[model samples]
Structures are given as structure tokens and as C-alpha cells.
Target: MAPGTFSHPNSSSSSFILVGVPTLEAFPICLGILFCSAYVLALVGNSMVLLVIVLDESLRDPLHCFLAMLAAIDVLMVTSIVPKLLGVFWLNSNQIAHTACSVQMFFVHSTTSEESGVLLAMAFDRFVAICHPLRYRMILNRETIARICLAIVVRALLVMVPLTGMVTNLPYCRSLVVPHSYCEHMAVTSLACADPSPSRLYSVSMSSLIVGTDIAFIAVSYGMILRAVLGKESCRRAFSTCGCHICVLMLYYIPGMVSIYMQQFSRGVSVRAQVLLADLYLIVPPMLNPLIYSMRTRRIRKAMLNVLFPRKAHACHGGQ
Candidate 1:
């Protein structure tokens, strides 16, 4: 049990308090400002990405479509928790209702899984474009992209519904203070008086099965892409096109993996470190995804520049 206020055994009426970054006790105001800045940046950046893709018909290629979907997911992912996080840090209002926490957990997990699925889909797009250039248009048309997006959403819900249900259904008679920034599945389950083995097992198994499979597919797709591009004049171009995606993948997964390992296996790791990693896992990717894609992808770069400097872009276009 956590060392905080106790809640009733009935899960419906219970509440949890989020104790965000106790190590920042000395600089709560500074931490709040920093977090707020990151949140605003993520929201604005992702919104710009979505707007650019929607406004520019030329940016409707399958790859850019996937990128837009990813940006939308990042926007939702950060919005799901960051507002409450600010409440905790700045307002000192840490209490969150059990139901609200459950909702947060669901959104966090679902959006995260969807992001992984989208990345894998993007990898497939890259693979098709590079290895099967002639068939790319026929293979990844509008209908196919729509189907892929729908399937990703469905998969995320199917995997997360049961797992989140298991955690929320557990009777939490113990302390209800979650020593983290947001209501995570593991953190919430840890507060239950009942043995959380089922929740734990499901968390690990589902994550391994879903996210692991996505990573494996991405790896194979990139492997084949590499094989196809090797020793060819297009090698540099292909690699450059995929570089931004690979960086986003690393940023998204590495911190999450480390946080999970620490939470489940490494008992000696400090709570502060674990909490910090968890915050990073959620915050860093969304804030950087738009920036990375904009800077690295030529099409997105030009589109963004056009949006920012339409007169100049128009002059350049007329000159061309």
C-alpha cells in the first residue's frame, strides 16, 4: 500500500492523488512552467501538422497521411494527461476520481498503441514505395489507408479494453495516492489491496504481444527496404526519407521500455528516476514528432514553409 490516504474498497467511489515529481519540491513553480511550455508546444505543433496536411492537397500521399494520423494521435495523447498534470503541479490539486483516472489510463494506452500501429503502417508505406515503387499507388490507395487507420484504432481498443477493465475492476482498499504524474495502469493497480498479478500479467503480455509485434514488423520492413536500396543510387535518398521515422520510433519506444522494465523488474531504481522516465515517455515524443517530421521530410518542410510564408512561397512558385 502506498503511504497516503486510504480509499473505500468500492472502486466506483474511490479517488487517487497524483504526487508528481517530489524531487522537484524545491522548484514547483519552475517545473510547472516547463511542463506547461512543453504541453503548449506539443499541442500547437501537432495542430500545425494536421492543418498543413489537410489544407495542402499535394500532401495527401499515403506517407503524409500516416504522418498526419500520427500527429493527431500525439495531440490526443498529450492532451489526455498533461492538463491534469498541470493541475497537480501548479494548482496543487492532485486528487483525481477513479473513473476519471480510468478514462485517462484508457486514452493513454489506446493512443500509445495506435501510435505504434501507425508507425508500423508508415514503415509498410516506406517499404512499398522503396521496394515496389511501381505498385505503390495501386497498393496504398485512399481506401487502403482508411482501412489501415480503422484497424489500428480497433486493435488498440481491443487490447486495452480488457487490460484496463482488469485494473479498474480490482478492489482498491489500500492507499490511493499514485506517486506519479498521471494515472497509469501499473500505478493505479499497485494501489489495490488485492493481488494485482492478473493486471500485471495482462499488462506485460498485452504490451509484448501488441507493441512487440509492431516493432518486429517494422524491423522486417526496414530490413527489406535496406536490402532493396543497398548499392543503388537511391540508397541515400531512401535512407534519408526513413531517418526521421527511425528517430521518432526510437524516441517513442526506448524510454517506454526502460520505464516498464524499471517499474516491473528493477526494484532498486529510485522512484524519482522512474517517475521522470514515465514523464519523458509521454512528453518527449509528442513535442518532438512534429519538429522531427517537419525538418527531415522535404515535402512537409516545403508545406510548412508555405503555410508560414505564403507570399514568399507564391513568389517562388511563380518563378518556378
Candidate 2:
């Protein structure tokens, strides 16, 4: 590991340089502005959602509790990657220590897996509330919701711990230049001088297992909910209630699935396009989750309005 020569195996002082959207080198200023704006909006939006959930006791149902948890996770997920990405884009500071890279990968993957679990839990909440209306309270009380959240955290840890271990122990003897914005597991592992096949396979399998299980459960829960809503009126109401959750699921999963497919199969896709898609997978959901919930869910929309216009809310309350 000489100073000038970059080629070295088992180098002691290995650091990864994250190359975030190298194709956008010409318009770094514009891209920085755009990404900064999105990051700020994600932070503010998710924070507001969490704030409203905390303040409004009336909105403290199981659904709202789950939404609050989701918002918090979104905040963490974006915070883990976006600030570093902003630094790469804005300040041109892309070098991350191996330890720091491992930390980023852990948080990013763990939060994502936790999000999937939370969505599945939310679907279960909806299913029980809709399909077993008489026993909904018994099924999904505060204690139950807390337990579900605990399980989500535990599951994410169980899956991510080993994956992180595998990636961190790999002998990164080659150039440590990560060809992406942040420290994604694939992006980081791909740089290893040793064979990365086992790490890659394990990563894909774990992701597929966790996310696939969640998706299957969500589908089953929603299918049951649909079957239970017998009448036209009930069907409409059920759809109205679940619309926000559905939209959030789509926003979270679709881009990620596409990115995975492109990574595996679409060799013809340009690196720039893949990098952009990867950013979208991480950036879009957090920015839009709060917006979709606020716009599509009447209760959240009303709660946000009340928070924003407290005096007006009090006036309306007095009139009522």
C-alpha cells in the first residue's frame, strides 16, 4: 500500500470515496440545490407528521401511532444518507472511513427493513379494524401496537447485523471508490478485491426474504379487507381509509424493486441512470410519505390544519 500506487490487498488505511452522480459534474451547484431542497423538505415534513401525532391526543389511534413510527423511521433513513450525499454534491467531501461506511449501510438497510415491517403491521391493523370490527380494539390495543413495533425493530436487527458483518469483513484491496452517492451494501461490497459473490447473494437473499414476506402479508391482509367490505358503501369507505397506506407502499417499493432489477439484469443501463434510480429509491419516499398522508387522509389533513392554524381551530371548536 504505497502512497502513489493505489493497488493493494489488505491495506490497513483503506477509505472509500463516494462518487455521487459523477455524470452531474457539470451542474454540481444545481444538483446540490435540488437535493438540498428535497432533504430539507423530507426532514420538515416527517417532523411535522411526528409533531402532530404527539400533540393531538384525539389522533392517537393505532393507525396514527403506526404512522408516527413510520414518519420517525423515514426521518432516520433519509438523515442517514442525505446529509452525506449533500456533502458529496455540495462540498465535494466524499471520503468516508470504512467504519463510518459500515454505520451508514447498517442504518440505511435497517431503517428500510423496519419500514417494510411497519407497513405490514399497518396492513394488519387495517385488516383487523375492517374485517373484525367488533374485536378491533381487543386485537390492536396500545400494548399490541407496542409489541408489534418491538418485533419490527428486532427483526430488522436480526437481518442487518449479519449482513453488515459480512460486508465489513470483506478484504477491500482494490480502489475504494464507491460509484454511488452513499454507502449502500451493494455499492460498498462491489469494491472488494476479494470475491464478492457470497456477500452479494446473501444481501439479495436477506432483502428478498424480509421484503418479500412483508409484501406477501400485506397482500393477504388487504385481500381479506377487500373481501370483508361487502357493500358498495363499505368498499368505498375501506378504500378511502387505506388509500394513504397503499400510496406510501407503492412509493417505497416500486423504485426499490426497479433498482434491484436493474442492478441484477439491466447491464445495458448506464451507470448514471442506475445512480439516479438509487437516489430516488432513498429520497422519494421520505419526501412524499408525509405529503401523501396529509393530502389523502382526512384525519391527518385535519390534524395538520389544526396545528397550523390553532386559533382558527379553537374558533371552529367554540362554534361547534
Q: Which candidate leads in lDDT? A: 1
* True lDDT of residue 35, candidate 2: 80
lDDT of 2: 0.86
lDDT by residue for model 1 (204-241), tens: 88887877899999999999999999999999999998
Off by over 4 Å in 2: 1-13
The TM-score that candidate 1 achieves is 0.95
Which residue pairs collide in model 2, if any?
Answer: none
Candidate 1 regions off by >4 Å? 1-13
**Decoy 2 TM-score against native:** 0.94
lDDT of 1 at 192: 80
